[model samples]
Target: MTPVPTAPLVRWYRTSLAGHPDGLNFRRLWVGDTFSQFGTQVGLIVLPLLAVSVLGADEFEMGLLATFETLAFLVIGLPAGAWVDRMRKREVLVVADLVRGLALLTLPAAWLLETLTFPLVLVVAAVVGVATVFFDVAYQSYLPSLVPSERISEGNAKLQVSQSVAQIAGPGLGGVLVRALGAPLVVLLDALSYFASVLFLLRIRHREGPIRRSGRRLHSEIGEGLAFVFREPLLRRIVATTALGNLAGSVTNSMLVLYAIRDLGIGETGLGLALSVGAVGGLAGALLAEPLLKRVGEGRTIALALLPALPMYVLVPLAEGHPGQAAVTMIATSMAITGVGVVVYNVAQVSFRQRLCPRPLLGRMNASVRFVVWGTMPVGAFLGGVIGSRFGVLTALWVGVAGQALAVLPVLLSPLVRMRDLPRGLDQHA
Candidate 1:
């Protein structure tokens, strides 16, 4: 077999930095995303705390909140994609961010007024969830326009790194803020983050062209996006792998808090610390991803990253000693897996999609893929709850590990493993 040519490390580094000539615009975007992500981190802590403290929610409610939040991706994803295609992606992102901020703000407002209720919290979650769907789809679509095709992986790696940083800092800070300021007040910080994002977006003066919607109806446009994803070989494989992986991951996620609180006997502070430690791995993964991809090629890099992470899932349940030791082990294993796994998978997948997709269809393609990939979370969460209730947490953890391991099957069976770089140009058949 002929050896596939790979981009040299020096060339890849140069390309990653100067790939987008509008360095200022890229910097602004990065800063904006980072700032808003900090707020998002706060909300992640506050929202759950609100459920537990103010609303007095049970495990079932927590599961339900996750279900509703993720279900928005299924309900709004395709249509939001079509809608985003018709408008400026940056504007869509700004509007979505603002809306989410408003929704989050309402939670604190209601609490202050002594009017907070479980139903009201549910409503807030759903609204925020819907807005997030729009923001995420638009945000993904906007990246290709912001940077060159050759540099897509690097750009995505940088963005993922920012998110990982926020994940590390946000949760720990949020835990502290929640303890000091109370959960309701902590939401105000996320609200401020959205405003910060809006200001940064307003400063960006670049003009993004609208998608060529022509005379297509909304449903027809959505269908076209779905067809486009399903018809492509590389996309089809990616969608299958990600969908399976996300579903399996969701099973563990639903029970994560329960396991930490009950099995490990860890408090909120300990949980935050553990998750923060894992973020270090994510940071390292993002920083190292480009070099790794250049050396190994995108396809093999993805395969290698995806396969080894499954073993880490088992480590969480194995932490059976003192709470401190268990927390540390979980954090270390999680950081290693998440940091590398997420960065590698995202860089490869996003780049592959950007290379293949037409600019006009970017939003639709993103939404369609996310719809399928994220749609499974609710079902997995529900199933996890059922299994946890029936078979217990240990058995559920085993199921999660097994399911994550099986995610490799799609990559192994597909042409992705044998391929190195993404195919150049658009092959209609591909």
Candidate 2:
């Protein structure tokens, strides 16, 4: 297949921002992304709160909610790539926003009708997950087309920083709203955020050409992409390690809030504040990633970032304070350190992926990797629920945090750790 024309990426900005002409278009995309992230973070806090508070969902139910949110990555991850490569990505993003918005809207509607149920939350979570699988695939693919290759790291950093900012603000605000209006109504904010994203997407003046599909075999294309990922040594290691990391992280994340409430005795407002404190680390990591990568190399940066996460993670189960000293000190420290590690690892790995892949294969390459890497989330979520149900939530968290440190093995054992820099040319994959 020939390289698709991505000139439309430039048309969106067609101007400058903060006195930087080169980044103007990116700023426009950034604006929409920032708003969208705020909404997502708000929903992130509110959704589970609704499940716990309104529906009285147990650990298994809460875990199931998390499962559905990521199940689509495993189910249609490959096919979505094939579809994305054949359609206008901008349109996919818009539709995804609308779908997520509509899906979230149902919760408030259900609440008004007094028909909201845990099962309904599960279904909507699945729907939103499906949309996200496509949106994220397209969003990653679309970025390479928008910026000069040299600036990819900058673009990613800006986007991540904005997301971190959202993390900082969204949860606190959502918690306040959840406390003020109740969890069900708090979802309305998320729904509106999606609509806001849709409007921003629609306002872009850029245009994309329709793909020709006369002789394309979808499976063949999907296989081609998958082959590229699994066959390449470096890509394989990254994919493997990421999958394990996510699986382990999900195990803890699946039960984090519940653990906070039960074990730590953290209230809604306090829970949000705890999460916000963590985002301070995320924000710091985003700001530091590019500079760190430049100094230490992607491999070293990843190693340094990830090595601390597990040790920090283990401290979470030990948090003793309810709302004051122990809660603020122990739980907050764990989350903040983990957040830093995650962001740094993400920025380095993502930048490496964008720099390494060929432009023509961007969408499928991203999807294939996403499939293998992200596919573990639901499994992990389910396991977390089972472990929490059978043994205990604290036990599940311990097992999860322990496994997180081991996720570094694949990359550490591979050639990635030996390098001072990522290979800019595909021929240097060795």
Please name the candidate that would achieve the greatest lDDT relative to the true structure. 2
RMSD of 2: 6.9
Model 2 agreement with the true structure over 107-141: per-residue lDDT tens digits = 99999999998889999999999998888888887
* Per-prediction TM-score to the true structure, in the order listed: 0.91, 0.92
RMSD of each: 5.6, 6.9
Clashing pairs in 1: 278-335, 282-339
Q: Candidate 2: list runs displaced more than 4 Å.
A: 1-18, 209-214, 320-325, 425-430
| Candidate 1 similarity to native, TM-score | 0.91
TM-score of 2: 0.92
The regions of model 1 sitting more than 4 angstroms off are: 1-21, 425-430
